[model samples]
Target: MFQYVFGIPFTLLKFLLLWFWGTLKRLIPYALRWKKSIANEIVLITGGGSGIGRQTALYFARAGATLVLWDVNPDGNAETARLVRDCGMKAYTYTCDVTKREEVYRVAQRVKEEVGTVFILVNNAGIVSGKQFLHLTDEEIIKTMDVNTMAHFWTLRAFLPDMVRSNQGHVVTISSLLGESAVGGLSDYCTSKFAVRGLHDAILREMSVLDSQVKCTVVCPFGVSTGMFDGVKLRHEFLLPFMAPEYVGRKIVQAVLTDTEVLYLPPYVQLLVIAKTILPTSAQLVLEDIIKLNEATKTFTGRRQDTPKKEN
Candidate 1:
């Protein structure tokens, strides 16, 4: 019993030392070199018909990667594919209803047969119903959850087996800052994003435990200029402005190339969580009210019943 107790300290010390070294390596710029190449990768992006998804597809196509674009909008998805082909890269597109699990699986099989195995899966598709908790209909809430969170599950189930077997892949979840911090009038949207973060983290840990080479990245950006949050007003534009789609898109591609784990756009967005933890609950409530995040959606006339691509 005495020897077993003594071994605990040494084991903990070793773990700390290794963790410290890992952190130091990550801090060094030289350690971030690409361990995998995108030039030959087959990347599948959901909601790729427009906005950030389209921008990301463009970036990857420029990098010489093949693309499979999936969207609910036929014209938008075709346009994304055309733009990629214009870049001298191959692109295939499908009109898919992500809320339907069987449809996700069916199209995934079609992709495998036609586009080869996807080396990267970007679950960028999401829906938002900017409404007060009491104002939302039951269908709207369920639809939001189905597209934003449940669809992630379906895509992973359809594609992850190949990634697991090969032990080489990347999963990118385009979540939002609201996932971590909640505000009024965004109950349905927040609920879906919050659950998405849960799934992203779980997949990351599960992959680590299995000793798989698969990597997971969760991107949490504030309001973006993707039309989905077009009317979102921010008092501090420089510090907390709505990010441009091009900038957000490029950052996502960079994260995947460098194997970044969690990326909060503009960097300082991480401080929200820090403030919440350090401040009292009353103080936190005051901060949210002062930022007008609660009222940000008051004038929200964003596209109603809009799919991610539909906002384009």
Candidate 2:
């Protein structure tokens, strides 16, 4: 067909021009990211009891967004709501077990009734088992997958319908660097996160092709100082350091405000992603050893809370 034969050059030209304009906008001072005001936007954050989710909830609240906090821990989730209210923003807390599909759906309904349709849905709830294959129980593995991977599907299904009708919403998936690079003791965790990364990419691409205004963001940050991964350590702390939860939270919220998609935190970590693509198997193994990647999680003692380090 002539359509296929003739469309290549135009497509290439459009891609190049778009790339150039994006670069130029970054270089220019006044011309920059299109900032979206979060004032009064209903933001529902899973795992908002503590860690990164709590911090992100606060970040959005400070920017004038109303908060809906979901967590299995009643005390901590209430505390986060109190903090948001202290910031003079409306906040409602719902104790939820994100690993359960029915619970997530039911809680989502209560949120809609008690708060309103969520303008921003941040899927920050996740759990890490920190156990090698076979060492982990069947339940632990399933729980990890449920919380880390399947919860995204349930939460998105519950909230995305309204977003489609309005065509104005943001979905943030707090993934992990482990999703990009496999590691021992984190097989389940990595698999789950990788699935989420793919999920976000698919959703974003679909939205783009449909000319939908719904924005999507996927974050892949190294371990944070949150208690969720209290004992993970690398040979060179400076080379591959764990980030602060506050910093991670702030960055994720900034990405949403700017509609920035696919974040690799601290910037330099992106080089590792590139290396993963180009480096051979042996070289990649050697690099992994140099960083003590596999050994790092051996000592990991994640926080004991039900939703510890929710996407930290």
Candidate 3:
């Protein structure tokens, strides 16, 4: 009884100290700005054909990292490789459907043999069906889960072992703000994003338990100007503007270099997450209504049929 009494206070004090230290770290711009070099690191990105993935690949290329791009669209993948090479960096392209486990493993082996081990694996491939729950078809739901959630498992299974063996690697998961908060007309998309978030968190914990040096970062951004959510609009644009692909790309690269574990783009989205946790159910509904959360996706005309699906 005496030990418990003393230990509880000590733990509380420790928590306060840690929180203060963390806040201080964030406040010190110079401290956070110090970034590690990725020069010559082999960086592989799924859905590198266009949008955020392509932009991120370009940034990594500029940083002197060799890039391996995987996508279902050969033409788009080739275009991305061309852009990387235009930056005076080496780039290899492979056409692979990330949703297929066998294809992921096979292509991964080819990457290992031809391009060498990937030091950074960016699981950025994702698709969204902007339909109400009842409007969504079985095929659409399955494809959404397969591309957004199951693909992560397949790619990680194929490549994470090497990272664990070498004890050096980084995994970046491109989640979304919807992953943290549910909204109407995006039930399938939300389900997949939530699953990936859970997967990323579980893997992070496992890495911690194993004392592994491999780092993981999960990015949750608001609606980006990427064609995927082209017509989607937030009710409060001034407070939460749709992010540019370039801005999101640059921030993601910065996060990787700085070893940031979780990133909420525009930063203010973090406050919304906090609000969701603290507010009662009725209060939350009121808040969502005020924000017109459900209406935001009412006009969501996703990427065009002719356009290649891009990373979120």
State each candidate's clash count.
0, 0, 0
Worst 10 residues of 3 by lDDT: 1-10
Which is the winner by lDDT between candidate 1 and candidate 3?
3
Write one digit per residue (lDDT tens) for candidate 2, span 1-312: 323334566667778889998667544442356778989999999989888988999899998999999988899899999999999999999988887889989989988988899989999888887888879999888888899999999999999989988999999999988888888888999999899999999999988898999999898997777787777878988898878888988888888887777778876788888999999989998988997988887887777655454553
Candidate 3 residue-wise lDDT, 168-226, digit = tens: 99999999998999888899999999999999999999998999999999999987778
TM-score of 2: 0.92
lDDT of 2: 0.86
TM-score of each: 0.91, 0.92, 0.92
Model 1 stretches with alpha carbons more than 4 Å out: 1-14, 21-35, 304-312
Pairs with backbone N, CA or C atoms under 3 Å apart (clashes), candidate 3: none
lDDT of each: 0.85, 0.86, 0.89
